[model samples]
Target: MTIMPNNPPIFSTRKIDLFVPEREELASVLQNGLRYHFVEATVEWVDCPDLTQEPFNLATSGLCGDAVISEISGMSYLFPFMESEFQYSIKRIIKEIYNNFNNGLIIGASICLRLQQQYLVQLGELIMNASFSRITEDDIEIINKSHLAFLDETTGRCALESITNSDPHCYPHGNFFISEGKPGQVLKVRAKKRIGLQFLTALQYSLEKKYSSGIYPKLIGLGGTFVMKSGRARHHIMPYNWDNNLTNARSIHNWLHYCDLDAPLVAVGTLLSSNLVYKDACKFSDLEVCGLTETHFHTFSSNGAAGGHFYTDLESMDPVEYLGYFYPARIFNHVDPRPSCNELIDFTDVMRLATI
Candidate 1:
């Protein structure tokens, strides 16, 4: 593998068009106004004038989720959600994508059972080593309490105040339309490597590990696309957090410069709509980004209905026996059926049989 840089790569000019047939008005507001605040990036938001010109084909298609990935410079980025109901129409598109990937089409996507924009962004940040900063226990608690409200309070005018009070060069903005969950959504952490938990815990863990190892991890203040990357992670976990709020970690870096190392230690956050965009971005740049995925090949929930079956069926043995089940569930799990004898593997049996 190539030694990719661990910093956020700079983006060159790329043409992006907004496709919002479902929420055209919202799309217009976001495309015309919101894009300007996020980056020094050039973009265009066009009204779907074809809606009136074309017949509306209302079909009850079974759609998992959808993602559009772009590849450049050997890295991939998941495209941002186009703010449309294309979710219902992406299955056919994904098949084309799958075929394209096989045929060397640099950009492609997969139709997950329940993929979302937030998940895409989280995955993208990991793929791209964007800037990030650590959060404190207090910060974590506050974020857990009222994240969306925190987002609302900090976006635009609130962000301006935050940047002024913290750093002159830093200004954050909130894209309200990209909001993920309802305010009442309960935010809690299970065994899964949640983005909220990762952003909160990874930095914490890095600090703890650093200190214990007699090395202080440096604190880096990530804003703009950087912090937005963390937000991507936040949305990826789909934690039942009440609100989405952009927090500042630059303060921590400025205040505590000694408790760190030469390697930049930062906590980053961003509000992204999908990993597909991030994946595509990776293709155009070279960066080392890390996000969370299952380590255990056949990991399953330890508390869900499937979890019970996982242990019982294996007679309390290894996890990879029915690993494909885990992947599908990770995408989205409404129903899970055990594999047939034909699907079971001999190597799987050996692990369990040896343990027995």
Candidate 2:
């Protein structure tokens, strides 16, 4: 007698891990980001004093809500306040997870904010490796100065400034030191000594080694959180630049290629971040699958296309999903309209893939 066989879906687990070392810190970072930008963080993997405290409501001109979790479209979210928030949130989550899961972990983390992608990726690299750096005096100075600007605003908007400054416990003091959870010592995480690109590369290399040996897990989760800024030097939509630059795209492409090079192949693409949908398609290069962004969601969703990883539209394939930052381009064009010809040129491939 002949027997029929069944195949498991490419991705089926859709549980995203959300965390906050405490509520106040989380609220402050999230609220501050929203005051400056429209989008909010979908997840907070790591919690720092700066990104944890609740911001003052006075800044909203009486418009701000009490909690960081605000409702929109019938869903609650942590709004994007500043670009830096993205990096802080992503790094925290990744570091916490990596410390616990190590190489066996395969999920990816992302900030819902569109502009913070670059910084988010930068911090992710730091988290992947067990590295920490002390926050510089200059960095502290800039943060304080920014807070002052927030304070200079009018009374009705005083709440905005308060939120930015509310987390006195975390900011400079919290960031300068690390946790003292180790044995025989109250260790502090130095802000100066941090993980860099080499660390991330080393991690990838290590993961590849294990995957090749068939000792690694096939599925992983991805998500992150951060603030947003839109006025001058640090524009609100800056994070999305990573999406257009082909950074993640190339990464996925390379990852897929690595599999061809003989490593155990793990399906790539975002396990989280909703709006950015991926079209399922046939796998292409390792980089294509390994490296990804919100836009790549399209290519990721396409069923059986070519160029990156396995072919198949991972459409709503759900592992865990979240986007800590994003903007409504349709309505805020003046601030974040479609990129100019030059900018568009930089992201052609990513744009083509995810329809971002």
* Highest lDDT scorer: 2
Which regions in candidate 1 have their CA more than 4 angstroms from the true location? 1-90, 100-237, 247-299, 302-356
lDDT of 2 by residue, 4-23 (tens): 12122321111111121233
lDDT of 2: 0.18
Give model 2's clash tally. Answer: 138
- Count of clashes, each model: 51, 138
Task: Report residue 283 deviation for candidate 1 (angstroms).
Answer: 9.9
Single out the weakest 10-residue window by summed lDDT for candidate 1. 325-334
Residue 319 alpha-carbon offset, candidate 1, angstroms: 16
Model 1 Cα lDDT, one tens digit per residue, 1-356: 12122221222212122221223332233223322222222222222121111111101111011211221221011111111122221112212222222111111111111223546211111111111112432111111100110111222110000111111110000100111111111111111112122222232232233222233222111011111111111111111121222112222112211110111111112112222232333344543331111110111121111100000121222211110000000011001111112222111222233223
Residue 179: error of model 2 in Å?
Answer: 15
Error of 2 at 294 (Å): 13
